[model samples]
Target: MAGKRVAGGGGREEDGSKVGLPAMDLALAFPQATPASIFPHSVSDYYQFDDLLTTEERSIRKKVRSIMEKEIAPIMAEYWEKAEFPFNAIPKLASLGVAGGTIKGYGCPGLSITASAITMAEIARVDASCSTFILVHSSLAMVTIALCGSEAQKQNCLPSLSQLCTVGCWALTEPNYGSDASSLRTTATKVPGGWHIDGQKRWIGNSTFADVLVVLARNADTKQLNGFIVRKGAPGLKATKIENKIGLRMVQNGDIVFNKVFVPEEDRLPGVNSFQDISKVLAISRIMVAWQPIGISMGVFDMCHRYLKERKQFGVPLAAFQLNQEKLVRMLGNIQSMLLVGWRLCKLYESGKMTPGHASLGKAWTSRTAREVVSLGRELLGGNGILADFLVAKAFCDLEPIYSYEGTYDINSLVTGREITGVASFKPAALARARL
Candidate 1:
């Protein structure tokens, strides 16, 4: 009996129509050592750096990795392409209960410094924008209050922020002053019950929609820098989103305008009195920034390794070539070295023995190495590397902001050099007179 033919794809014939040819073996016949799988599973951790982590630390990494893979990985590329923030994912992220990182109490997670550092690395392993968003919220904004806010302020703010009920941003850099944060232009005039903040902040993360903003303004009376908590919908406070950024596009960086914004005395952070006080925050954050590149570099390496294994040219797999293998090896070496440095930096932080200069050195060295690693990854990918869909292009561009921020490469190096040498290089070059 003749079978009726379907009008679509299938090996069938009806009436006098010819049957479709037998299915051909179209799969590639390349020699392989192991079955191919989509990344993460096949990623090479050449040095077994996970062995150094504690059980809690590894658990945190695994949990965060799962979150990033399930939630962030699906949508990050789209958000990056649109240059928009993912407002919807905040709840799921907050559910992870890592907002406090190393901070104790006030509904905070109270995790160890190393564990917190591991979380940041895990986040960066997927997307730098998401990790930087956390860096701004947890490392900078929440930690500012944890370290310097009054008890009443902490009781009021910390719980909501810890739960992600309220997103916060730390405002310190201004349009005219980035590296020289001490020379800020923002002014806080003393008023009847509080302060009238009149100035602006630039490059503020989470500023556009954050419920709370921690602003740094110089006191008009004492001429000292101070931190003030300003709520959203303040009469004269406006946060305009910065546009056309090439890196970290998913983060909502803003130019915040303060037009006589009044903050109650209770909102003022009493503990932040000087640049020295602010340095406390920077010291820890710089260490975290040092870890960011390590994760980002590992991500780049993972992508390259997978591409090399699957992509073929001249009827040979890319991974089979010697030059391509060297590139991956170099990237892995950079990742391992960066991982060790960041781990040691965390130990120093845990011991309370980490100096700002030591942190500056780590941040400087690791970010520099990551640049090389990402550049090599882009090369290994050839033409496909430029597309955000492949991951390396976005990561390569994202590394720029990370490199320049925290501190410029030369600036961090000079900071380390200043600590090693007794002389300050930033001071005016009076060596011309010393020659006499």
Candidate 2:
């Protein structure tokens, strides 16, 4: 191919180089020279993660992102500042048709795991509390019923739950049974036609206003774990709101007390007969949490990206600095790996080969990586990172609760360890009684 003459003077090639204008200006075309507004926001799928999602999945992600950016992003800081839940967003959120994303019946949309995971990440990328609210209702509470409830129970409960007319909370954590769920101290005694439960649940999301609570209790007679649907304001069910939380402040974490809360046999989940059964719900939920941090990190990444372009130091964009760019790339790399892990986990779930170990590993690894990315993001933002208005600081704090929930960093590692080595590491602690 021959070079073409420039319109005014020197010949030009297909590369669009102005022949007369020396290539010296190339240095001026640093990253942000492209202009700030053109930069895509809240998006960090660097490794073509979108290519893995189906068209509908992409649509769901886009729709959820749009809603987050448009509605939730504006007032979220105030909600987080006030430590209040956005009660008004329920109908709009419900209308998204993602409540029973993986479940195929009872008004559930039954989207693929990839779609659901993307939705969670998108929502979390803006507001973690909102994402937690949805995940608690969708993946945790709804899945418990969809996967474990009787057909009658499913028919009666899931429709409204999907519609967002009713909110749900999964109650497994207690003041003492945070990690040792297998040894839940909650008791369920069989009555003539119902069961009576007496236990306290700690850090219960959506509990204060949850229309239904999915509580796991040990059978008084069999000693096996069983699931119950405790309705809101049930005579004996008291959901005391927990306050002064440093992280996830908008999540409405509550200390729920089950004082002789009676759940009829019809309200019981027939399939949840053991702690192992709850693990099935957790196996996927853990993966969803892994997806969540990617969004949280992505949100911070977007903030940092925008901050670097807009904020100038030493007469140039902060992002124009080598160290700043390197940090940004590192954050991107961590987020990309996090997304890849979550995507592969979803693929495994779709293929019926997703083990609890897979979910635990992804959750643990991604949460750990995401925490670093967010921390770096706070560093990049300098003073702005500490402000809730910026969201980076909020996510940094919110990560603390998530880093520990589902399974702690160490506990999840232990879970993965057990799967790999075929051995249980959890042994009873030896008492240190003194011989007086």
| Maximum-lDDT candidate | 1
Residue-pair clashes per prediction, in order, are 0, 0
Q: How far does residue 341 in candidate 1 sit from its true spot (Å)?
A: 0.3
* Residue 94 C-alpha lDDT in model 1: 90
lDDT of 2 by residue, 36-90 (tens): 1122386577788888778999999889887777777877877888999988877
Runs with alpha carbons beyond 4 Å of true place in candidate 1: 1-39, 42-44, 427-436
Give the lowest summed-lDDT range of ten residues in model 2: 31-40
Model 2: clashing residue pairs?
A: none
Which tens-of-lDDT digit does each residue in 93-122 have in candidate 1? 896678978889999999998898888887
